[model samples]
Target: MKEVVFQASLDGNCLFLNPAWETITGYSVAESQGRQLLDFVREDDRPCIQTYLEQVKTGKQSSDHPVIRLSHKMGSFRFVEIFVWQTLNKHQQVNGLSGTLIDITDRRQAEAALRESEERFRQIADNMEEMFWIRDLRERKFLYINSAYEAFSGLSPQPLFSDENAFLDFVFEPDRDTVLRVFQEVEQSLSYQFRARHRDGSWRWLRVRAFSIQEGGSPSRRIGISADITSILEREQILEVSLKKEQELNALKSQFIATASHEFKTPLTAISSSVELVRYYLNREPQTPFTAVLTKHLNAISDRTTGLDELIMDTLTLSKLDEGKIQVCFQEVDLVALVEQVIVANFTNREDSRQVAVSVLGDPVWVTIDVKLMSHVLTNLLSNAFKFSSTNPGLVIEFSEHAVRLVVTDQGIGIPEKDRAYLFGKFFRASNVHQIKGTGLGLAICKEYVELMQGYLGVDSTEGIGTMFTITFEK
Candidate 1:
């Protein structure tokens, strides 16, 4: 009877009777003896209490572990584990049941919290992109792997616990030795990088970081993470290749410029000597037909000299652009009149006069620009167009108010698509255009000048369909 007092019962009419029950509920025996037990059971706990009592009355045992409710006098809830067992009469007939209740509120709450923490950690590991792994160094096998590893490798690492070499087999052939060496060093180190072959037959750069876990009397274990660094590795390779190519291109440009300068000097000296001879003859000429012939030769010499001068100037401009020496000064000017003047200056030759026709479009309006550089740009484009279109008569030049455009369209021969990329590169000539007399510096110089003046220059051409060189200067 004394042990039975540790349990409590409320009959159909709700009466709490027992010294131990009073002690557990923080109520005097007198206060609980005739009061409804529902008064002690929290409202939220009444349903479970009723269900449990009903189960006991139906010859069923109350196996529910524990529940919580406030004590009447203590004013705080306490956990109680309730267990019911049937008692027998002396004659071995059926009898009412008795129950044992123990306090377990604190222990149950701790267990629930631990479960929630574990679930949260699992969710984090599963959703992460980086491969996470844990291994027992003593056993030399994987103990755990995150979902990311399984997806990345195409094979779950969980089975690798029995075969320590499984991970080694997945390393790329070129990086296998390095990875093995790194692993050997990891016993003393904590991190390394290597390449691993992915399931898609490509390789990924992987950075691995690990720490050793020491357990008392047991071998040390290792926890590691592997991150994919393929994009970083690719960018590094691309940068290296680009740097090497730029160096080679720079060297090539220097050599080409040196050769072009030497080539231009010879032509320039011949033209200068021819000009001096013409001046000497003109000083004593009696205006004879022979004098006119000499004058024509002098004009030819002058044209050749002008061509050589332009070539030299183009080379010098490109060199300056390469060295970042050119500066632009923006000012308002009549772009239409500027284009007309450049065309007149460049169209002086009989061949140019007979072959190309010049035209203007739109109203003449003042526009902001660097006049000197813009004139150079327009002259180069018109000269190139006329030079290429020498066989085709009536090549036209066009202009507008809001924009100053020069179209030097040639019908002689056209550029190929593959050669377009190198069109603006110094000393680069299309395969078809190589036969045409040119230093190939004209367009490159034009690009630099146009860009310096904040204008746009481009070309359009097709094989056998002729070519059009266009320059649009901002107003």
Candidate 2:
């Protein structure tokens, strides 16, 4: 019913028209009956219709099918396909034409819309900076590649359509095998970061990501984008070189510190010995005022020389630790005995030794620890406790089946809460302890030693109240 059936004389006069003619062109069947069929055709297309009809009338073509624009009653044209054949009389001679006119306006408009959409897509793809491509994986052919590919690869995109592996030929030799493997094994998605030779004879870094597109019952396609990452990689290389240079400078600075400390230690030792000799001789006749003054200055010099010597020793020890020259030798030692020995060795002769108390709580704790490192840790902690607190400094040893803990407590000016996080950092001294004499390296060295023995050294402190330092080791 959508098509109109009609008969017209061979001279092009309309003899009969169907009711569907009104539906197709907004013209009544009676009004269109007597008019020529050319009256309903667009003026520009009438010549084409005339030529086709002439050919059919002269027997040059048996039947004619021509798509032409027909004028509608509303001042617009509609596309229609005409299928006409000659009608024969009883004498077997052509007399009239019979045809069906089907409205094809919708199909024509759809085709036009498709062309416009394809144009828009092409424009967008061609303008991108990154290379975009589409390949029919099933057909082993490249379907689409943007102009950026030609710009980046310095080659025509034509050969790629026929030879899918042409780009692989330009891939840097070191990365070619990896790229090939990735392509062969790819399933849903793939990503590759590699270097490839560019048009300028330079290797360029590219980061490519590809995804498989499989539509219902259609051949699979691969759509991917490749971006130039050469600039980013260059920046990273520069940063790596800068970092290496900085590390080398730090190594040189450490060497200088080690050398200087060793050179100063010998003179400091001699100064301390000379001061002791002067003091020993002056003590025989030291009742006079001048001799008393001389003794006081000598004692001051001796004390300073001893402090200098201690500083040099601490510096040398830290340097060795930094260079990884100190090796830990672990031996099973009694915790209680070790604590007592460190206390007697470091604090027994001092006046504050009386304030130090030792307690063994559970059992005789034994731990595998480096003897020298453990001794050093115990000495530092106990010395700090006695120096900071006015009352008793408690050293408690607790033991269990799986763990051993040595807790050192002091009721002194505790570290500030804000400074506790950085307490163990090299040369980091709490603000509250600025007036106290310390080299600030003792805790840092202690922590390193404790960790080398596979133990943990932790601290808890409250400003103006107390501090507790704990060293824990697993059996």
Candidate 3:
């Protein structure tokens, strides 16, 4: 037996102690022979042991009492349940006591640890943010849910167990069919995400995941967790709507700019031809009154009109680029000659133009490129140089059968460091260039044009010093 049985004489001296006692106390029969029973008890428990012995001897109690701690040879206490009866002599007078002692130390400690573990589990489950549940899959019933279910559903868990299918009523009707379909399948795992109708007439999005517990390959139970995701869903919906509206607005803006630019180009052409004709007449009569004044005013008109015309054309180019409407037809052309013509026309049109020093590395270098787009790229780069540079700027054209580079460098006020990253973005202007008369679309259009020919456009600049624009086309 696991019980430690022992007997003591009326004087409280040990008369017999069993093998289990030796095993428990680490004291053999020879060592415990002459010792009193109280000798093995701890000092603090000695009084209790003495009192219990007195009660048993006087017949005040028997068979059961509160546990007492006894000392083991290892110096640790062992709790034991002791039952004692009065031993009788042949004359029916009380002699010594015979008792049964059961060591309950392991049992007590195990009970304490179990209580602590259960409390910890309860605390975690009760305070959990996510809903934890266990359900009988075949019976279609919820067997367990934590306290969190009350806060989520605004109902106590007890009523949920009173009737099965209570969870179905919380699910929105539109989502019920899908939920039913998912649960109907005998799968090992199931997950559901949908809106569930809340108690207050509002809908809450819930994400539920479960794994089926099976017996003999048949569905038996399910363990599931659910979390509320309403706030996340609402935020995503708002962002989607905002993105759709922004895209629509950008499309309308592009169409408007394209139409307006197309309308402006016709009048701009007429004004340029009329200005040329007036200049032709004035030049023939060089001795005419206020001849210089007439020339200056006419030139001012021409410059302003040309600036307006360029802005409109830049806007139109940006619109077409946005719509991917630019056609790139590759044809062989003398790119060196084409660049020279662009520079000459730009300089000839300006009354007070900066001198552009040109260097050609090869004679009549032929390349395959889109003629119109390349013309725009050269014009934009040279115009930017002429407008910003204070002295002679250099334009170098280097070409070969496999590669071509057109580099334009100027001693102009360079782009600010902060603006360099956004320089090619549409309608983005440098912080320092606010006073310059520009629509901020020139570099953007130039970049798109170069990219259309499968070429690269890059800029090197230091603030307040100088800037260089490089366009390279490679086969």
Candidate that would win on TM-score: 2
**Residue pairs in candidate 2 whose N, alpha carbon or C atoms collide under 3 angstroms:** none
Q: Per-model C-alpha lDDT, please?
A: 0.71, 0.87, 0.83
1-475, model 1: which lDDT tens digit per residue?
2221322333533233456665566777776655655567778888886677667667674455446463558677666656654456798654544565566666878999999998998898889899987777776777778898778878768567788667887887888887777665435347778888787878888998887776885447877889998998889999999989987897688667877877888878887887988688696868888888878888877877876776787776676687677888889887667766776776666643453565656655677778888887766666666666646423343455466666667775678889988998888989887656787887888787887777788888887877887777755
The candidate 2 region of ten consecutive residues with least summed lDDT is: 347-356
User: Which scores greater on lDDT, model 1 or model 2?
Assistant: 2
| lDDT tens per residue, model 3, 1-475 | 5587888998888888888888777788789976898888778878877888889899997555757777878888888877877799999998998887788999999999999998998798889998888878777777889987778887767866867556777888999889878756667887889777766779899998889888887889887788998998889999999989977987998978877877887888898999999999999995666988899999998988988987887777777787788889999988878877887777665566556788887655678889888888888788788778777778898876777899999898989998899999988988988878788898998898898888999999998888999999885
The reply for model 3, stretches above 4 Å from the true place, is 1-121, 128-130, 136-143, 173-177, 184-189, 193-197, 201-205, 211-221, 228-244, 273-306, 313-428, 442-475
Error of 1 at 321 (Å): 1.2
Candidate 2 per-residue lDDT, tens place, 1-475, comes to 7788999999899998888889889999888988999999998899989988888788786444789988889988789999888899999999999888999999999999999999998999999999999988887788999999889878898888899888897799989889878865537788889898888889999999998887785538888899999999899999999989977886886888877887887788788889888888898873898998998999889878776777777777787788788899989898788777787787776754465788887878568999999999988898898778788789889887888999999999999999999999877889998767777889999999999999999999999999999999887
Whole-model lDDT, model 2: 0.87
Q: Which candidate's lDDT is highest?
A: 2
Which whole-number lDDT from 0 to 100 does residue 319 have in model 2? 78
TM-score of each: 0.45, 0.60, 0.57
RMSD to the true structure for each prediction, in A, is 12.8, 10.7, 8.8
Predicted structure 1, TM vs. truth? 0.45
Top-down lDDT ranking: 2, 3, 1
Runs in model 2 deviating more than 4 A are 1-162, 169-193, 197-203, 206-236, 363-365
